[model samples]
Target chain A: MIDYQLLDALAAIVSEKGFEKAAKKLFITQSAVSRRIHQLESMIGEPVLIRKQPPKPTAIGKRLLNHLQQVRQLEVALSIRSLADENLQDSPLTVKLAANADSLATWLPEALMLPKAEKVCDFRFEIIAEDQSIALKRMKAGEVMVCICSNEEPINGGLVSALGAFRYKVIASPNFVKRHNITSVEQLTELPCLVYDEHDKLQHQLLNELNKSVPKYTHICPSSEGFKQAMIAGLGYGLLPTLQLGDAIEQGELIDLVPGYFIDVPLYWHYWQTESPQLKSLRNFAIKVASNKLETLA
Target chain B: MIDYQLLDALAAIVSEKGFEKAAKKLFITQSAVSRRIHQLESMIGEPVLIRKQPPKPTAIGKRLLNHLQQVRQLEVALSIRSLADENLQDSPLTVKLAANADSLATWLPEALMLPKAEKVCDFRFEIIAEDQSIALKRMKAGEVMVCICSNEEPINGGLVSALGAFRYKVIASPNFVKRHNITSVEQLTELPCLVYDEHDKLQHQLLNELNKSVPKYTHICPSSEGFKQAMIAGLGYGLLPTLQLGDAIEQGELIDLVPGYFIDVPLYWHYWQTESPQLKSLRNFAIKVASNKLETLA
Candidate 1:
């Protein structure tokens, strides 16, 4: 039988990023923390951790962490169900989710509010903002319990459901289009543009649909709020959600470089097929609320 | 003498994240990319990359990356000066900066505007949000060219200057304080609180000043915008910047739990002591803008 103490030590190390800090959190000595990991490695007959300055988990270690997370989530739900009545738990349930920043800035906030209003679960969120194109990695890497992302393909143990879409437009200031004289779609490749980060593919995907090569010059801004701010400041033309850009588009403060063209990037919720009671409620409310708030995919 | 080709290959590998992608970017075969890395490793007599899935830089690799980045920055500045008469460059300069999310949401945006207003240099930013408590690691690891952080200490080759402070207060919904009957600071340790992440130290610092133990329950939210939304939604009490919470506090939508008590987290601009012409201008303007906008320390 695998000892949870050994698993807990691994989880703490990953969380704290060092044996000393992990020891403090676990209320054990640093050597004790090392011994637990050694014991775990002996039982598994494989190295779970790569010993370095601030150790990192191996592929097997990530799987073990995933297992521990799922088990702990189940334990929390079971305790809430059996020991306490209603949505009361000994502590607030932390639902770690990976999501695209655009969704977080717009529809997801409203979706977050729904669970609280409907009394689905008394939980707190730990949101990790990843570019939509690569958010699936967070779930597959065992970093998060669920993911609200652009990718529809679910991981092996997870289920996927449609969660509507964010309607995005390639936007620029009037000065930008005027300065570059970008009247035609084919001319876009020569001008500068904005990308959320290296992983952001919205600009490329939209460009491909328009039959243009990627813009040679790009500004990479990782913050969603800052991304829009940079676009408005005429840093470069790039795709942003119309939900947040409504007034700017309507008032001509920000012009849609592509007049009528917009990308309906569909969002999907990827979560464990087998879920705890609290998590099941979160999944239900997130989908229900997102469907009501976001642009529906045809 | 180190070959620029080998350094460029190493930089591309780090930027593109893998040999295959780096090969595509550099217009070279995968074997060529491997050969360059092998040559770089041989010259250094130490491994540059960890050779894992998505190869991470070794300690020496990071220092080499930092050197390459600084050299590239100088090259861009020289070209901008000689080849281009104006702020015009072959490509816009990209300044990768590490900053806290709260700063990004607050005064940093205003500071960002000043450079563009003055035409310091035609540059774009790549921002990485690391919590204020641990942001120095970004500079030490060569992940960012510059950093706006709370840490005042200068690194080996970098300098730090005061950028004023973000005044923070312990806050909650009026209903929350009443519901918990939390009139005294001692009772706060028992109630649930909100934290940005494990790396965030503001709450603990405030708690220490208040002579209280760490809160028994906590909610971790990483996004600065969403963090406030959660706090306002009565998810949990947390320390937030008064700049964003001024109207909320005055209107009683959010209450300052510890009346007349605030923490001024001093901000600093950390950058290389020797800077390129474009970067020197940026340093001048960022400090100028931030000093005017943020809370002045007594």
Candidate 2:
């Protein structure tokens, strides 16, 4: 097994470009840094450094540096969560999560509510527009702990857990629908439509389902919050996450245009396939929250 | 103009969960942090924080936090590069580049070398899978300064510079080709093929071009290094970049089959649309290197 502490020392040394400076920056002795590097190289049976004027990293060293950088970020986040947990005496792990704008504006908030709340882990959410592959990359990079990904294929070296299917319905604010007298999605192309930027295929997918062309005149609102606000303010019609419509539906602010049709998006939870206690706790909490929210809404 | 520093402070405070603690972590005074937060809230014209118990970020603050995180990373990278340049006294603006595996194994190294040393900056490369959309996202997220993207459509917030085109030819080690007695591509359908993981479209694109069915016995090589090694080791014959094969062909390591027919991929340079002097220097270096390489090779 790889000693993570050695990897961390190596990454710091490589980033600083010398053991002396890395030691000074890390508040450690230069010999300690040197020893750590030596031990790591001996363990790996490969020379990781080219001890030139500035001590360049060998190819293997660079690869290890990249991996170490990712690991270091994860460590930092874990440390912060630990600190937070100690301070609060309840919150333990911080699960940094990223999802699409519509999903964040829709069902994600409700999914943050933990049922058991055993270890007192706090959940942090971020809305990003990356595709599934990119989402997996972020997860691996340790920028985010959990990713709500569209990919059915499991990311290499990551745990795969199903989050059930999320369906999207073509929706419009009641005022906008009433003012435009909109009924079916066939007239979608003619009406001004709000979209989640260029990469968002929700509108295109809906148009394709209706066997109609994608509208040429469309306004780009990249955030789900902004998209929902725009639609409510009568900017345009859009396909919204069914969960996003719940409060609006109850308040009589928004309504589905085409009742029978919806796009079902299967979601999965992908995390780094590690045996850390905090990661497992986060995974369980997310699964529980996802199940409860999905069962209640779907 | 948005003050990036304010956003970073806000994100740190939100992540830290309290004013005093966030200040201590950032090595700043609590009053300073409080003032910054007030300024941010005033500028955004929204209450960004909930002051009850451990502070929580408002929904808009959370959105800002995500954007600020990306911006903070870019700012950190830029600062690190700037500091490295100041200390190293030479090659301060080393460009961190990202590309697909095939390009890295093939034309990218050639393009990295400028005819004149003065025309080049220090270079660092991160090779990834051929999914250019992911590369673009990485570039946008500040993981890389430059990227080779396939999509002609401009990355929403980045500038695009054309780098001519790279053509991929179906090739194999001469020994393997001779051993298999392969001539026509139709025969290739019967032979084993190599692919770059499931997401790779190279072999599929070749088959589509030939109007032939995909070979069932496909060897998967996930990395560019692995793919090249597999071809050299005679694991299977597959498409190789024309640039990558040049030295191999001359050295009698590889042979092109039906050389006239090849896939032409128009490559483009995508970078952040910033006017920073460091970015400008790196951009100019890339353009010079790319143009010189293309002129010499094409």
Candidate 3:
């Protein structure tokens, strides 16, 4: 077990970069900081900090540093929570969330605005990819209070509620269409198409819809932000989430081909079946936000 | 920032549920752990441990503990990496993989049995749906070396090779079939069906093939393993992944309904354009395994 003082010393030293600077930051003597680092190295049986003019952490030290930083952030969140508990009549409510990259990049950002909603509680967002079920397991372990996933089944007693369906469209840059003389998804084989990631389903889904195979030419554009950029760059014709494509389409950067043929993915928000006030507030707020953006299943 | 020592102390205390027990675990005096807790609270200006008889952590404390655990796991992984680097004459290789839950629960565990898979290098597996475009983004991020998705698009700088088309059958236990007396996918709405998750297109795909909407009474089965279990438990009818259903069907635990109709999600392994040794090894091995099990697309 590490001593609190020692971990504090490590954080201070890493942030300060040198014994002298760390000493000033921690209000300790430079020699004391050096001694503490020595003590930590002895205990861990590994050299954590590299001794240099501007000291840098070894891989071990870097890992330790990151760990400490996360701990500190948690502590900070806790303090705020405590203050809310004392000052407010109601306890601080946290809305734990899980979402995918595209959702995180697009509509999920609206979750940050939930705190400002009429709800009188704190909201904590844990944005994750839709692809990560392990995170869902964490939610099952009570790590998160709520999750927005394609997974409709409740994990470990979570209440499953339908949010809505998000529609996606096969899109390409106007320049791409003109350059390749393409009009249909079949022409995708002859042209490059932007994709969110290697595991992205747009191209595959496109082919499946056409009762054809996936095209031969594809470009990996992993980031949602970058996906738009890649489309504009004419890297390839890619599937664009309707929400993201709206602005680009307005700007004449991309064109929605065979517009009515869109993919609608049904989404659901699963929440821990708990009776906490904070969680209730979040659940209601999420429903309200999603109701506006997502198409309710008729 | 949280003092690392405080986190360590909290973990010890949480595990033991008492100061004395925690001290014993840490080989420190009870007073030492108590003092550290107190010091941590003061530093963070918040109370993390409830100081109850058993000394349970507050929600904030729990959050900090979770973050610390994640960091610690990363640290251990990094440590193992360093040790491997020092011992191996061959350069360390990292392989990134994207897969789905069905594969994860069934075929994937056996697929990763490469000799010295863990010892010589690091393998990061990113779990996603069998959708191809999702895998493409990971490939673009340089995060995954290969993906098992339903896309056969030749990535601009990558190669697209067929793994196989996995066939899924609409299945139900004999008990369930007898109870429901179901005949066609149209009667699916009348009988409860198990959906893998909200984003699972299986149910929707089934409904779309019939040009109908998803039924109202469909039960959400989020996990692949759990979904199988639920189907076996006669919770509902569902489309079962072929690999998982084979043995169970043979054993009469499950029975196929509407047998001739199946969803064939063709899988492909797309690798990066680079010739990195780590990637080459993974690509060849994956191809070898896939070829044995899957039909090639030529």
Candidate 2 lDDT by residue in tens digits, A1-298: 7887787777667657788888987788999988998998998899888775466567677667646544644674577566654664233233456565444444454354343455444332223335433566555544455677777676555667887666778877787777668766677777767666546777887887685687644654444444555566565778777765657877887777888888877778776654355556656766776775553333
- Write one digit per residue (lDDT tens) for candidate 3, span A255-288: 8877788877777777654434555565677677
Q: Show the colliding residue pairs in model 2.
A: A91-A120, A92-A120
Give per-residue lDDT, candidate 3, residue A18. 72
Sort by DockQ, best first: 1, 3, 2
Candidate 3 lDDT by residue in tens digits, B1-298: 6678878898788768788989999999989998898887888788888765667677667666656644554554566556746644333233446666555444443344334553235333333444443656555433345666776785555677667766678887777777677666677765566665445678678766764777545554445545665577565777877776747888999888876788877877776544444445555666666666554453
Candidates sorted by TM-score, descending order? 1, 2, 3
| Model 1: per-residue Cα lDDT over A177-242, one tens digit each | 777788788877766677877788888887778865776777776767666766666667888888
- All models, RMSD in angstroms: 3.2, 30.1, 25.3
Ranking by lDDT: 1, 2, 3
**lDDT (Cα, 0-100) at B292 in candidate 1:** 78
Q: Write the per-residue lDDT of candidate 2 for residues B1-298, one digit (tens) a residue.
A: 8887687677667657788888988899999898998999999999877674467677677667646544543764677566754543232233456666555444454354333444323332223334544567655544455678776666545678777666778878776687678867788876667765555677887886795677645654444444554576555678766755547778877777766888776677776655344455555666666665443323
Cα deviation of B68, candidate 2, in Å: 26
Error of 3 at B97 (Å): 16
Better of 1 and 3 by TM-score: 1
lDDT of each: 0.79, 0.62, 0.62
Q: iRMS of each prediction in angstroms?
A: 2.5, 19.7, 14.4
